[model samples]
Target: MKSKKIPERLESKRLLLRKLNHTDAPGLYANIRDKEISRWLSGVPYPYPKDLALKFVLTAIAKFENKKRFTFGITIKGIKKEAVGVISLEKVDYKNKNAMLGYWIGKKYWGKGYMTEAVKEVLSFGFETIGLHRIYANVYSENPASERILRKFGFIFEGVEREKFFKEGEWQDYLTYGLLKKEYSKAM
Candidate 1:
């Protein structure tokens, strides 16, 4: 399987999974900086500062230099020029041809199927464009919405741990889900 030498932006029916920009800090910060939103997310800290957001965008750009995996700033197609969510591929193993998918969306947009749509677009990119063999999503057991999105993406519930995460000052269970190239190919 061959990875695209150049990173490609993916577009779905309602989204443009484009590259993140430093200018996106203001809009992204507005939606993602709160503890309510960042609670379960591992690296994104509560009360995320503008400086940190800028750093995030910078790091996103830097990922392109390596060329195997990338993240996107999720923007709605018809809406104003702003990011309502962000999604990405991480821990890509080119030899194994796999990557773990992750995402976050604005709270107001929850229950609208936005996250599922975005996940589908990226998974399609991984399997179709990037020639990847597998993709997976992990979530805290309490995050039913994320679990729902992965299920809708055709990921199967694989396993769970007793105390796989420690977030917001407490320990919690982590639910792991995964989809294989074989499974996705069969579904297609």
Candidate 2:
């Protein structure tokens, strides 16, 4: 399957997934600044500096143009402009038709199915628009909520990598989940 540019916006029942922009820096920083929010995320700096947030938005813009990744800011429809979460497909491999999925929602947005909704839409974009054969996500072994979300989406349990990431000053285990194009088609 050939790759296509990700759409400017994707909508579900209550959420709109759109491209991140300069104006989003403050919201992105506010949402992700919490240690609880940043803990499981591997690369996000713990302090979550304002400068880093700005840099992230800029980098996200660059990555999208290069087709290296597609990142979306999650906002409630007709509720506000600030993002409550973010979701993205990174490490895209055109030859292998695969990519890595990553996402996080603010604690206030947890248990409301927002991430689930956003992820399902992003997964569709990955498989249908980007022509990905497989899209995978890795979760911290201790994070069952994330694991449950992946399971609900029909992502298969692939394997575990012990001490796979050094986060918050300690090594952590990671559980991998994957969904193939055929499986996604069936689920959809």
Candidate 3:
């Protein structure tokens, strides 16, 4: 299959999702360093070292360039340089036309509908722009907010994986949600 060029930036009513850059390190560090944020995320370390943010930014850039993953930094309209969160389509499988969706916003920005807006934009890109067949997300069962966002987009609850992740000194169940292109088109 031929590759499609992913856009460097996507815009929503109140948010701008753009490719990660070197200058995003500070903002990424500030938002991701919170223990509350890191606990929900499987990969992020608890302390969330300052330097790791830069490393992550650089790695995201490389992955974007290689078309391996698409990671967008979430920023509000006026303040484009300061990222409040991140949303990504990772583990992209061009042959299968599927990808996994992952996202998180800072504690300060939660409950304001920023993630819901961002997810809508990214799902559009993945299904319509990139021509993906399916997009799925795995959320820890403890995170009802994340599950609600997926439900709003018409993602079906596929199933649950028992003891899928060990975070914060205990095992956690993962609730899988999936949306096919047909489902997205119908909802839209």
Candidate 4:
């Protein structure tokens, strides 16, 4: 597959999405370690490991350079430079022009519409910058809030993946959502 150019920084009305690095470890760890934030998240470990944030940051940097994935740390503009959330487009399939979208915000920042702004910018980057034709998201059945966000962004509910993952100590089902480039255009 050919290499893609992923922007290092993207700006929205109230947030800045930038490439995550080692410097973000402490802030990322602190924000994501909250049970409220990590509970519904699939990959994140409960009682998150002390070193996991730094490891993820390093992996994100390497993945970007490899053109395999693009992960951005989300921070509020002019409020603090530290990351309060994370978003990513991973498992890129250049042959099919598709990728999976994943994101999570700190519990303290919930209900603020910060994630909505971040998602908009990332969607634009995925469709316009990286030329992806489809972006999909998998939301756990229990996470209605995330599903609502997906719906608001024009993502169609495709189907459910039953017992798809073992997360937070139990098996969980996932509600799959997909948004095509055309659908996003129409939404806009």
TM-score, every prediction: 0.92, 0.95, 0.97, 0.95
| Model 2 Cα RMSD, 1 decimal | 1.3
Winner on lDDT between 2 and 3 is 3
The full ranking of all candidates by lDDT, starting with the best, is 3, 4, 2, 1
Indicate the residue-level lDDT of 37 in model 2: 81
Segments of candidate 1 deviating more than 4 angstroms: 1-3
Best-fitting candidate, scored by lDDT:
3
Candidate 1 structure quality by residue, lDDT tens digits, 84-167: 778988887888888988899888877878888898888887888788888987788788888877877679998988787688
lDDT, each prediction: 0.81, 0.89, 0.91, 0.90
True-vs-predicted CA distance for residue 182, candidate 2, Å: 0.8
- What global local distance difference test value does model 2 have? 0.89
In candidate 4, position 60 carries an lDDT of 93
Q: What is candidate 2's lDDT per residue for 14-64, written digit by digit as tens?
A: 999998898988888888999998898988878888899889999998998
The alpha-carbon lDDT assigned to residue 141 of candidate 4 equals 91
Superposed Cα deviation of residue 180, candidate 1 (Å): 0.4
Candidate 1 pairs with clashing backbones: none
Question: Residue by residue across 71-122, what tens digits does model 4's lDDT show?
Answer: 9999998887988889999998999999999999888889999988999999
- Candidate 2 ranges beyond 4 A from true positions: 1-5
Best by TM-score: 3
Candidate 1 TM-score, true structure as reference: 0.92
Tens-digit lDDT string for candidate 3 (1-188): 33656799999999999998899889889889998888888899988888999999999999999988999999999755677789999998999999999999888888999999999999999998888999999988888898999999999999999998899899999889999999999998
